[model samples]
Target: MMDSLEGEELCYPLLLNVSCRGLMRPRFEAILLYTLFSSITVLTVALNLMVIISISHFRQLHTPTNLLLLSLAVSDLLVGVVVMPVETVRFIETCWLLGDVMCALSYIIGFTLTSASVGNMVLISIDRFVAICYPLQYPNKITRSRIEVSVCLCWACSFLYNGLILKDHLRQPDRYNSCYGECMVVINYISGTVDLVFTFIGPCSIILILYIRVFIVAVSQARAMQSHITAAAARKVPVTAKKSERKAARTLGIVILVFLMSFCPYYYPSLAGQDISNDASSWAIVSWLLFFNSCLNPIIYAFFYPWFRKAIRFIVTLKILEQGSSQANIL
Candidate 1:
């Protein structure tokens, strides 16, 4: 019994030592990789937060899609704030130094936010498809109340789905630490597998299908509008309407492209059964790809919507001028 007690006492520190192994090396190449990843992660999260703050501070962005975007921004921000910092330190440490409780909490938060982000995207795609394909019906179909309901449902589903972690049967007599070093309890394999399938694989598949349908509808609508424009011109109809339709199509294309590019990198490895490793390069790349989603949201907005650029520019210039005036006053 004394030996067993001694063994239990050693487990915690031994785990820490194991987690920190090889982490202190200052290898230039490894540093470069992780540094690059960390920079991108920070940049992306920063952009996400900036956009969220800007929209909240100014009420002009209260549209349904923007509201959904806000939800996504919040989720991504949590990943950026709560998840990435710890993860990065673990990367540098080369181990899970924090223990089981932190590990469980991090995993739960990361997974939930990620689920919400992807889920919101899917909902947005569905919203866009309806707006583009059935403009007249869209107003009646997707009212503010409906949007709110959908958002609530999205969040509720996310919460309940992740809440299954409560049912996880794993007893961490040994403190849980993530591959990265945060102390958290690991869910047993069965629960973990179930959560992964339901949260990641299932929603991802649905999103993929929805986007595919959305693209098809968008392309068809674009072609139909073009033909209609040609006929309208033949009949001497106003050109402004046609111009608006063309612009909308282009914006949709850009949004779809950005979404695909940003998400594909993060999902591909997981779907492919690729091993995640402590190799600094792999961790760096994963970090970049994941946090990069947060950044791309605002960028996609700015690129696809002229109004977003105007909002961002106006906010940025106003801040700069305000800061300059404050400096002059101080001097």
Candidate 2:
């Protein structure tokens, strides 16, 4: 009985000498953390799932930009479905119980999804810039086929890029673990900094620049429309089109701003090329913050869209399951 009790304290009982210790916190504290993380994981999956259903089920929700959003939702859904739960298990147990292959696969999947989401956001910003600044060319430049191709490229690049990031670890999954029952993949500060710049900072800067131009164009168009209301009825089509562009610009701008705010702190270490060691005391809390921010995304993104709201109503009322529901005029 004593041996069994002692073995429970270590992640691997038989290999006690080299095994990492489990979370030794008070039982209440451990339970609390587990419950909280579980809630976040479930909420993330539920919210992103709704987004995926809303976009995919509604024919009217299909657009170049919504397609990009659908891509993001898919990635974020996987983060919740695959990444968050894996992370939660790792965090609560404070041990890598799933073995070496899972450890490597989890990080690769997480990074790829995150990187792909950023890529989709960049594409969204470009789409808005063209739609608002050069309305005449929007349709030709941001066609359905082109957007589909871009999304495919974004995901493909993400998978390829993340694989390269962890190539060494992939080759030898146990390479960095200091002992049995431990799971770790190390990225030297230089490689991490390079990743930070390429995957995060560079993309954010591009998104900001594009959105700024979009905002300027949108504002000027708004003013011009305000001054020409006398003939608004005569030029209703162009005016409506411009108004829709402005609304999309404004709403997506807010979404991008929120994204920047929540994710900025997570990447702040990149500026100093700081190492992200799991052994750091702040790892649990800091990592937990990321999931908290994720839940806010569906709230902010969906709040701005009437079409999304309509789709939610359908989904909630179970009308979405009705035959021919996809033909509903959601817009």
Candidate 3:
């Protein structure tokens, strides 16, 4: 008979000597938590799928900005489809059932998606900065082809950079395992510090700087509009220009804010000069916090962007399946 401590059990009872222990929770609590997390995984996949289909299928929505959004949705969708399920299992079971190869692959996918997200955010910040601060030059500078190339470069760089960062773990997935049923990876201080600068601090700095400039320009334009309102009222002038810029600024600002919130907690250990360990209980919470951002992104779009709402309506009603639907004027 297998020995048990209280209600706890070994992950691999037959190989008890090499097995890692699993946390035992009450049956009701385990069921409830599983249901909750499964629901989030489903919702995240569905929301990002809507974004992907809306952007890809609709010809009218195929702008440079929307392309960038499509890229983001792809990363977010992978988070739901690939990362979240595995992570859910990891957190809930508290032991690794999958073999060593899978362990390394999971982390690679997670890091790649994360890096891609940051890259997409940076591209979006630049897009908005140019649109709001230099409206006239935006048309000439931000072309569809250029944006496509940039998105490809962003993804390619993310794959390359993360591969380099996790190269050793990929080479030896079982190196950090304490027993047969454990999955973990350790980054040395030097490697961790380098990753911190490139992946976290550097990209965040660029995003913040660009958005600040955008914000300043947006404020100045708002004030100018206020000043002109009285004078322009006599001439029946249109505030369309000011309204568009302000709206774009507001939407992107919310995106940046949410991104920061999702990412900061995950990196807190690094910022505090602590080694990131997957075995820590706090790791589960922080990892899920980061993953939850994917779910919130489509919610943000649904709330802020009218086109997304219209697209969702069409998608839900199956209007998108009709012939020549791509030409439908969603904008």
**Which candidate's TM-score is highest?**
3
Best by lDDT: 3
Model 2 C-alpha lDDT per residue in residues 125-223, reported as the tens digit of each score = 788789878889899889999999999999999999989888887889898788878878777787688788878779878988887787777777766
Assess each prediction's global lDDT (C-alpha) against the native.
0.61, 0.79, 0.84
Better of 1 and 2 by lDDT: 2
Q: Write the per-residue lDDT of candidate 3 for residues 1-331, one digit (tens) a residue.
A: 3454656678889997989777677789878888999999999999999999999898988889888888888998999999999998888776688999999999999989988977887888799889989999998999999999999999999899889988999999999888888899877667677778887788889988898888778767766776667764734434665565667577667876887888888777778788777877788898898899888876774446678888998999999999998899887
Candidate 1: C-alpha lDDT: 0.61
TM-score of candidate 1 versus the correct structure, residues matched by position? 0.70
Models, CA RMSD each: 7.9, 4.4, 3.0
TM-score of each: 0.70, 0.87, 0.91
For lDDT, candidate 1 versus 3, the one ahead is: 3
Candidate 1 deviant stretches above 4 angstroms: 1-23, 27-34, 165-193, 227-288, 319-331
Give the range of the ten consecutive residues with the poorest summed lDDT in model 3: 232-241
